[model samples]
Structures are given as structure tokens and as C-alpha cells.
Target: MSEAGKANKARSGGRSGGRAARRTLRTTRDFRMLPGLTRNIPYCEVMDEAHVERLDNASMNILENVGVHFRDPIALEDWKTAGAKVVGERVFLDRGLVRELIRTIPAEFTYHARNPANNVRLGGPHSIFVPMTGAPFLRDLDNVRRNPMLEDLATFHKLAHMLPALHSTAHHIVEPYDHPISQRHLRITYSSMMHSDKMFMGMTTSPKNAEDVMEMCAILFGEDYLEDHPVTTGNCNGNSPLVWDETMLGAMRAFCRRNQPVLCSPFVLGGANTPASVPAAVAQLNAEALSALAYTQVIRKGCPAIYGHYLSTVSMRSGAPMAGTPEIGLMNFMIGQMARHYGVPWRTSGSLGGAKTFDAQAGYESASTLSAVIHAGANYIWHAAGWNEAGMHCSIAKFVVDAVQCAMAHRLGEGPKWDDFDQALSAVPDVGPGGHYLGHPHTQENFQSAFFMPELFDNNSIEQWVADGEKEITERALNHARNLLSEYQQPMLDVARDEALRDYIARREREIPAASELNQSY
Candidate 1:
């Protein structure tokens, strides 16, 4: 055989053998936290000390001068007791007190899951990834995108359990149109409990929904255990232009008083809800985030809170909101810096795309934004995978592709390991000049982990590619998704605990009117 032919054979054969050895890695791979690069290496920093100070002051000014409106009378009263000046519904905070309250937040906290093995540690040095939370539609391999059915939601939870890339299956993976409105939370929580054992978000639609999820969680983990240890979180979204509506505040109150974490995030699209400028938008984001997070502490001190940022710009031509844009990347880094400055963990997003289908546009936009946020030091990443059409739809093909990327990103975040430097150095001398180190001891020892294995991406020579019929990555990913579903086994839950959950759901269902009744009542 020619020398080139021998090299190609060695490469292909060795990798194939590695795959066989690690076949079980896909099913049992339990790396939950995708770590960030070693702190010794500087990460991307957009703002210097002076810029950070300016931004901090800008946010504080908004809090002190403009203030935020709290529509809920109870929330307004709570803030008033915390020494904020309350003018009707709007509450203006004293910056000194706000600074003091923000300092009370812990640097790190543990979020226990239904299955103890899948519990997650937020803040500190770890970077955790979660799936897309709220998508109204679903797209499967047939390539038909439509409103999600009840079964689709359960399937997503199962997929999250099978794929180790996902640390948790987010609540409401996709809204189930088939279920009744009043009882959707019961089914959503039950679906997650049945299919996934990981930590998840709770319902924030209303205080009652939040209570229902907590009651179910208590059934799984004794009520006493859950009170001291947080198991689920609630996403408390702040209305743009400095407003805190009643429903979200009620949810936050429910989660906070119980010692569960709540992500205080603001949804801002520049040139619409917020100003066109990045600095202004970030300042506004901080102000809103601080207001809501401070409210959590007031409800109960030392409640776990994450500084969440979800900022995107509106397209000038069509007024459509864009994700994973250059402007978004720049603002994300700054927000991360601010989060760290306040000694709080940051909750950011990734795998966000504007493409309608799982294609090139999805690949580029999703990967770019996800990487940028990870490198910027986001702690809790939602919408980590399966997000398509600017968060309008979720795709299984995209989910599989992003799962592979999540593992790869974590490997990169660990930075270079030199634990075996002396051994590697000795092997270099064994292979003298003009000789390939294909058979060197160091190469043999490090080969398995030296490269990030592509789960769906095909890396082949042009000749080999041509012989394989040149399939698109999405088609390959679809095959992997199908295989995952076919082979997945539900993780075992204790029979009594499962029975308790079923009983809770059964009783709640009786209280909720049927779909026909729901339609008439509304």
C-alpha cells in the first residue's frame, strides 16, 4: 500500500476501535456540568473597571430615580417595609439598601433533583446547561412543524433523560394544546417526574400553579427536606419598561417563601421595550433584574436568586427580534461581568437561532451565541438546545446536534491538561526526526480524550465523503434522535413515590374542569 493509504487506514481503524470501546458512553455518560475554562486563562471581557462602575451607577440611578412599578399590593407593601419609597404602585429603592441586600445573596447553592444523582450546583466555577423551556410548536423528523400535542411534551422529557448533554428537562418543553388550561401545570410536572429525574423549572403562570408544582415536589422529597433544600426553580420574568405584573410576582413570592430559587429575568427587545443602545439596554436589564431579585430576598432573606439576562435587538426593517447577533454577543459579555461584580450567579441563554429549519443558519447562529455566553461565564444556560425559528419552535434534529456541541464545549472549557507533561515529553524523544508518532506511547495514551468526538458531524476525507452519498448533518442527526428514542429506558422511580405523584395529579384533575368546561368558563 502507498504511504498515504497506510496513514488513512491507521486513522480510520483506530477511531473506529475507540468508538466500539466507548459505545456505552452515550447511554451512561453523566457529565452534568459543562465546566468553563480554567480561571488562570483570561476569558472574553468587554468592560473594564471604569466601564463597570459607570454601568453599575447607571443601573442604580434607574432604581433610585425612575424606580420600578409593582402592581401587586402585597409586593408594594413588602418593598415599603424594606425601606423603599412607595409612590402608589411604583417603588423607588435606596441604592445603599439595595447594595446591602444584594450582598446577602450566596455565592453558590445546590439545586437538588428528584434523582439525587442528577442534582446540580449553580454559581461557583461550574457552568450548567438546561433545555429550551417554553416553545409553542414542535418539529419532528417528518419535517412538519405544528403545535405540540401532549405526547410531544413527554417525548422531550424522555429525550432529556437519555441524552446526558442536558442537565435538566425544562418545564413546558413545549406547551400541550391538547391539555386543559387550568390543569396544564399538573400534567407538565407529572410528565417531567415520569420521564426525567433531573432538576427542572416550576410553573410561573400563577401562584396556584407554582404551589401545585411544589406540592408535587414535596410528595417526591418529603416536605421537610424540600423546605431546607431547593429542588426546582421558577422563572420570574419582569415586564419591560420597569414593571412587575401581578402573576409573575405571585409566582416569585410562592417560590421564594419556600426557599426555592427563582430566576429574575427581563425580556427586552431593543428599539421596542428598551432603548436602541446596548449600554442603556443593559442598565435597564440590571435595574429590572435587581428589583425583582431584591423582592425575593425581602420575601425571605438568603433565598437563592440568579441574575438572568435575556436581551435581543429588534430588526430595523421588519421589527422582528433577532438572536445570536454580534450586538447580542457584545451585550452578553458585559452582563456577565456585572453579574460577577455583584457576587451573584448569572443565568444566560444558548443554542438560540432565528432559522425556521435545522440547517446552516441554525448551526452558525446557535453555536456562536452558545459559545459566546459560555466563555463569558454564564452559570445557568436555558434554551441550550432544540431552539429554532427565534424560539418559536423546537426541533429534535437540532436537539441532537446541540447535545454533541454541549459536550464538546465542556471539554474545551476544561482548557489544556498538562497532568502527564513529563510522560508526554519522554515520548517525544522516543520518536526521532522524520518519523511519525502514530505509534508513540503518548499518542496512544491521550488519543481517546485528545479530540472532541462528533456525535452527528461527519469528518471524512473528500473521497470518503463522496462514497458515503454526502448526507447533510441534519439527516444524520435525525437518525441519532430516532435511535435515542428507540433505545431509551426510563430511570426507575420508587413505586410509592410514583404512586403519591399519581394520586396528587388525580386529585388535582378532579378539581380542574374538563376541556369543554374550560372553554365555556373562559
Candidate 2:
């Protein structure tokens, strides 16, 4: 077993507190194809052998016919030497090359979250990690005024540290104290080393930033550790339009060589980037696969990669992405099915309700979208909670509510089963038809133990609600968030380690020029 595995096992044992833990629920229900849910008619395919073959062929077509464009000269030249068709900046890949690349990718890997207890397994069977803390700055609820300089990076770091559902925290917004050029890279490395046990590294548009941040990680974990255990890292958001600009392709190749995971977050704005129809949206997803798959294969034979699709609808009236739209939820389901068909891991967005006031719309939208992804079996889930205005803000109240929903989804995914149904009809002979089971031995034995009942969901009468101050879900969720925040102690970091981390950040800050200074005209 790996060191992480041993540590997790030891932790789990102590955490169980001598109580026999409930067995994880599993389902035997065959995967079903849901149609017309979105205009994007997913070519219905699940994790079947034939479906995998079809996906392989489709990817090859993308590589051969609809080739990817690389903006970087070095990346373009590398592809040219590899026998790819380079037209100006475009690299047209062949079907055979794509197949060879796909064959070399690994099927499974592990990811370590900052909290050792929160580490996740990324491939093989489906599992998920939710997003947290990715806004400009922590919003002060009282003052509506937006200030980029308000919250420090450490504050965002602590907030991420406190969130239970967030297995990995991305750089929590840009900080004022850091350099613009090196700010992102510095923040990612510092956050990962100081606050998190595991990390998601890479910026979608910045190749230099990705290189610097990943280099820091390689230094910390050692290159051999990255290649062997390969649990410490992953890359994200080489966005769709599916062309790998030279910089992104270079990063993908380098990360792939180390056997690190990469995410293809194709942000498809319905009417703009894609066709207005759903099928057209899915075709855009195919475009994402073409670029990401080719990059993965070229960098290292069979590097681990995930197929991620975020289909946020653009409101024609407002001209903003509608995150909580039903189409978004349905697209998440379809994307999971598509990724499974290709025999690759998949991820989707979650718990993002479009409500401005943190009300029922937020709760309903977040729950519904999250439920669909969980049921559809997505391997990784971003924006799991605490998002508002389509990723422009993070609400602590919303995050708390979403975390509970995530827990509920995890329970629901376990599904109803016989092991969960302990007592047989014959064993409960005394409880005759319509007889009260409430006071019976079997009832006492199973009632609390059998179900994963939630504490906040009020199943009480309206009279009870009225008597208890007529609190809505948001009110209850806010209360829960406050309680959790108050109750949550910082995860243990030794004094020496803490000082070392602080010193490291301070030293780095002094070395790099300020964001303003770098841009100033001499």
C-alpha cells in the first residue's frame, strides 16, 4: 500500500470510533440512456466495450480530419517533426497517431487533498471532488462594493481549509500581495504546500504560469514520486475551441510524461461558442476530446486524462451564462455517459444555483444539478458549492447548503439494497400486517441505523415550521454554515511547519516585482 493509503486507513479506523460503519451502497441497475433531455442528443453509450470502440474511432476522426491548431511556434515544429500536418500554426493529427497515444494512457490515479482525510481516488470506478473558493475575493455581505484588495490569500486559504466537501481547492482568487506574472503560479504552489495536501494545478490560458506552478510541485514531491504514486497533482481547463495553442500543448505534454491527470473543461456557451441546438453542443464536446486526447497521447503514450464538459446556457436577453439551467444539468448527465463510453474518466459542474438572493432557486438548482451528476456517475465534480452569478462569486451560506446536498447525493448514490434491509419478513414474525413496528425490537434495531436521514430537511408539519420561526431552507442553511464555521478548528499544522510556510511566501513575495510595478512604463 502507498503511504497515503496507510495514513487513510489509520485515520478511518480512529474516526469510526469503534462503531461498525455502514457499508457503501452499490447498485445492480443497468445504465439507461436518457434522450431529448437536452437538444444535445448524446449518441447513447455507456461503459460497454462496443461503445469504447466507437469513441476511439470518433477521436481518431477528430485527430485526422478536424485537426487542432497550435499557436506556439515550438509546439508547431514539434508536431511537424512527429509527422503531423502543420499548416501555418495548425497541427493536423492522423488517426493512427491518436490510437497509439490513447493506448498509452493510464486508466486510474489518486489525488491527495490538503486534508489527508479528504484525498480522493480519481479513476477506475466513479468518484467526485467538489469545487470551492474561486472568486476574485471573499465578498463582504454587508457592503455590495467589490474590492479586489479586500481579502488576503491566507483568508481564502483558511476558508478552503474549512470546507468539508471541497476535496481540492483551486487558487482562491487573485491576491493583491503577489506579482501578476508569477502571482497565479506562486499562489497555487503556496496554497498546495501550505493549506492543501493535494492540488489542482494549471491555468487555462497561461502556459508559463502552468510550468512554474508545476515545477514547484515537482520540486516538493520529487519527480520520481510524481511518476510512481502520481497522487499529488492534476491539470485543468485547456478550454474547448479544442485547439491546443503551443503553450497549452507543451504543458500537457510535460504533465502527461509524469503520468499526472489533466482535465478538459470545455466551457460551451450555448448560443455563442456552439450551435444553439443541444446536438451541436455535444459536437463541441467531441471537439474538446479531439484536442485533449491528441495532446495526452503525444506528450506521453497513454497519459491519464478526464473528459470534462460545462454547458452553461447563455441568456439571450442578459448575454450571461445561465449556470442553473436545466440544459446544464442534462448536459452534465450526457457528458458522463460520453466519457464512460470512451473508457476515460469524466467530471462536471455541481451545486451552482443561479439565484441572486441565496434563496430557494439556489437550493433547488444546486441540488437538482448535483443529483443528476452524482446519479450519472461523474468521476470529478467542480463548483460543487459556494458559487453565484455563474462563478463570479462564492457565498459561504450557499457553500454550506451545497455541502450537505453533496453528502446527501453521496448517500443516495449508494442506492437502496438488501444489505441495507437487514431483517427478513420471517425474522419479524411478531409484527403482523398493519401492526405498529415503532416500538418493536426490529424497529429499534434498524430505524436510526438503516437510513441516511438528514438533520436540516424538515419533515415536520407546517405548524412546527411556523412555531420554529418559519425558517426557510436558506435560513437553515445559513445557520448550518455559521455553526460549521464556528465549530471547525483549523486542521493541524505544526508551529515549525507554519513558520516555514510563512517565511517561504514572504521570501518569494520580496523577490518578485509587484503587479503594478511590472506593468508600469519606465
Candidate 3:
């Protein structure tokens, strides 16, 4: 564990007492994937030999026969030169070519944070969690939902930095609706850099936004330093059923060419954007993922790219996409298998749901999906906290709740430690003949670091909980979030560098026209 983990034990509040007793526990260095640690165990597998072979063959057939639609002419030319069959916008890749290209990508690489001690590696056995992103509405604990202001966007970044569970965050934590669409990315990108020392996602709204993201990174890391160290990633979604749009491709060109990563994801909803059957959806998801992955290599061989899959079932009655569904978890397992097959980093959804509020439905949905994410040995998880309402809203209550869950998942995924088990067993003699072990020396020595201590869950006695206002979990979460935000301190950066970043954003905002082809999403 990083020293940051120790900070969690320094203080905790939001309980009913004058102030809750903060857990004074030491860090679980052996069993926790903290901000800068690496995981080293073999990932648990879900598919057998035949199942893996079948899925791979099916995805290969889709790419070679049905083909993926590449909208950008430059991309089509790149594929053509790589010996792919090109008919209009459709690019048919040979299976061997894809397999060979994939091998060029490194299985593991470090993503540096502004704080050198906080650098995290991708494509390892560990999991990295980021906060909810791209939600247009912000929902407070009071159930007040509205288009978020620019100040609200900055506050979310500050909160994310204070939360130890979050290693990085997506760029637009919530859309800053108070600003004009054209200027929104500028401020969003600037806020993340200024507020957090951890790594984060780059802007994907436009090719120009991609340029600004790179410029800001250069200002922080310096030009030559960025050549070997990647600091951020972008989630580039392919239009389902084998299609890559112009904006996504352009953004990929910008990020991949600079030796940064783009999570090549398929925004698939089973039976809506993909086939209803899990296997069929897996095949389509794999095919769509291949197209995006292949394009990244085509642009720059060995550029880090993650195999991303976001699968969900559709509500038959309303045609709305449903997250945290049984089918989605199944897809997540298969996606991990395929990523392992290709030897690349894998990305999956987290704490995702379609609930309209932070109630039973939301908790059940996020819990089920999060469990699969841990079991699948996923490497990167986005929307790990605060996502709700079919990705339309990010809730403050749920963010706090999910942070607790994320921390628990990391410790759980680490499995149990067997070190010095003999000492624990030695205490069995002291507890023989029905004598309690609670007062034993071994128990006394191990109690604080033996388990995962939650940040917001109440473990107090019933009487004590009642005395402390009998607050609900969500109510406690709201207060915990407020306390975290209140305690946040901006990460240190050189004063000149900060000014350079601001000047760059200001110039880009003035230079870019108010209206452009790719401003629709913002």
C-alpha cells in the first residue's frame, strides 16, 4: 500500500457523535492495490479451451467476412496498406494480421501521475478505478438534480482527488452546462490537471480537444518526458455493429500517435445495439473491439490500447438500455478472457446501473456488476462511483457508497494473506477449552489490519447508532462526501506550469470557432 492508504485512518467523520472515532489502522501493504502498487497473481479464468477458441474464431469471421465500417478515409488507407481488403468504408482484416499486430503492443506499461510516487501500471493483474464520467446532470443528496455548473465540475475533481480509492478520473466528471459547449472541454481538462495529482482521461469530444489535452500534459510532464511516459487515456467508443465514426477515429489518431492509450470500447446494449444472446453479443463486441484495436496499431504500432466492452440488456418495454444486468456480467467475463487471449490490457464497466435514485435497485445493480469486475481480474474500471439513471446522472450519495465498495473489492481481489499463519494458529492453544480469543494477544495484534475498514458504513452498536440520529446509509454518504470535499487540498504544481496550462486553454478557446462539427456531444 502507498502512504496514502495510511491517511484514510488519520480521520473519519459523518457519524452522529460529536465526531466519530477514526479508525487508527496500519496500511494493508500485502493485500491492497493502493494508488501506486502492482498486482502479481494469475488472473482467474471463466472459459475453457473450446469456449475461448469458439469466441475467437467467431470474432475473426466477423472482421474478415462482414467487416467493420471505417468512416475516415485516412483510416481506410492505413488499413489498405496493411494488406486488408477495403471496399468503400468497410475494412476486412486478415486474422493473422490482427494477431501479429496485437503482439506488438506491450502487455504492461506505467501511466505516470503528476506525483512520481503515484505512477500506476496498466495491463497488469491489478484493477484501476475511476469516477463516473460524462453525466450531464448532477444529483445531490437532497434529490436536487440539475445541469451542473462549472464550479460543480471542479468540486467533483477535488472530491475525486481526496478519495483514496480513485486512482484517476474521466475528464468530464459532469458536463459543465453553465459554459458554452465550445469552451466546456477547455475548462474540464484544465480543472482535472489543476486539482488532481493522479492520472486522468483525456478529452474525446473532438480532435481539437485531443490536441489541447496533449498540450496540457506536455506542460506538466515536459515534451521529451512524455515520449516515454503516458499520463492519461481516452475512451473511444465504436458505433456498434462494426463501425467507427469520424470524431472517434480523429481522437484516436491524436492520442495513439502520441504514444498514449485509447480504450477501444463498443457501446453495446444486448438486443438493442447487439444480439440478445450473450455469446452472439460477445462475438459482436469482440469484432467491434478488434476494429478499434487494429486501427490504433495501424496508426502507431505498439501504442498502448485497452480492449473495452460495455454490454447491457435492453428494457423490452421501453427500449432503454439496462446496466448491471445478468447478461452484462457474463459479457464482462468473456471480455476478460478475450483480452487475455490477445495479451492486452482489459477495461470494463463498474458500479453501473439504470436506477433513478440511490435505493435498493441501484445498490443491487452496482453490487452484482462490481463483483464480476473483481472476479474477472479487470485492469481498468470507469464509472466506478456515482453513475446512475442510465448514465444520465452522477449522484453524490452513490459516489461515496461506491468508494467504499471499490476499496473493499481491491482488498478482496487481493485474496487473503498466508504470511505468519503459524502465529495465528499458535494462539489456538490459548483459546482451547471454549475460551474466547477476542482478548488473546494474536487477536489484539491483528484486529486493526486484519480486515477492510469501510469509510462510510456504520459498524457501531444499535444503541449508539440510534443515539447518533439513526441516519440512513445514503444520508451518511452525503455527509461523508461533504467532509471529503471540505478537506481537499489542491495538488502542488510549479506556478509557471500552472500559468502555462491556463494560457494554453485560453488560447485554444479563443482560436477554436464557437461552432464546429464535433461539438454536438458536449
All models: lDDT?
0.82, 0.59, 0.81
Candidate 2 clashes: the total is 11
In terms of lDDT, the best-performing candidate is: 1
User: What is candidate 2's lDDT per residue for 387-470, written digit by digit as tens?
Assistant: 765666666556656666766666566555566354645446686754444445564566554665665678555686999999
Task: Point out the higher-scoring one by lDDT: 1 or 3.
Answer: 1
**Model 3 pairs whose backbones collide:** none
Q: What is the C-alpha lDDT profile of model 1 across 1-522, one tens digit per residue? A: 999898787667566554544553545444343333232234688999999999999999999999999999999888878999999999998889888888878778887887777777788666678889789898876668999978999888888877776788888988898988788888998888878788788888888788888898888888898778988888988889899988889888888888888889898888799988988899999999988878888998898889886767899999998888988888889988998899998898888988999988898988999889877878888899899898899998898788788777767667777888788788766877555555665666676666777768787788877898887887888887787788777878889999999999999789767674433222
Give the worst 10-residue stretch by lDDT in candidate 2.
Answer: 30-39
Give the TM-score of each candidate.
0.92, 0.79, 0.92
Q: Write the per-residue lDDT of candidate 3 for residues 153-268, one digit (tens) a residue.
A: 88788877777777885689899887777777788988888888888889888776787788788897898777778899988998898899888898899898889988999988
**Candidate 1 residue 141 C-alpha distance from true site, Å:** 2.7
Candidate 1 vs 2: which has more TM-score: 1
Angstrom error at residue 461, model 1: 2.1
Q: Model 1 off-target regions past 4 Å?
A: 1-41, 514-522
Q: Order the candidates by lDDT, highest first — what do you get?
A: 1, 3, 2
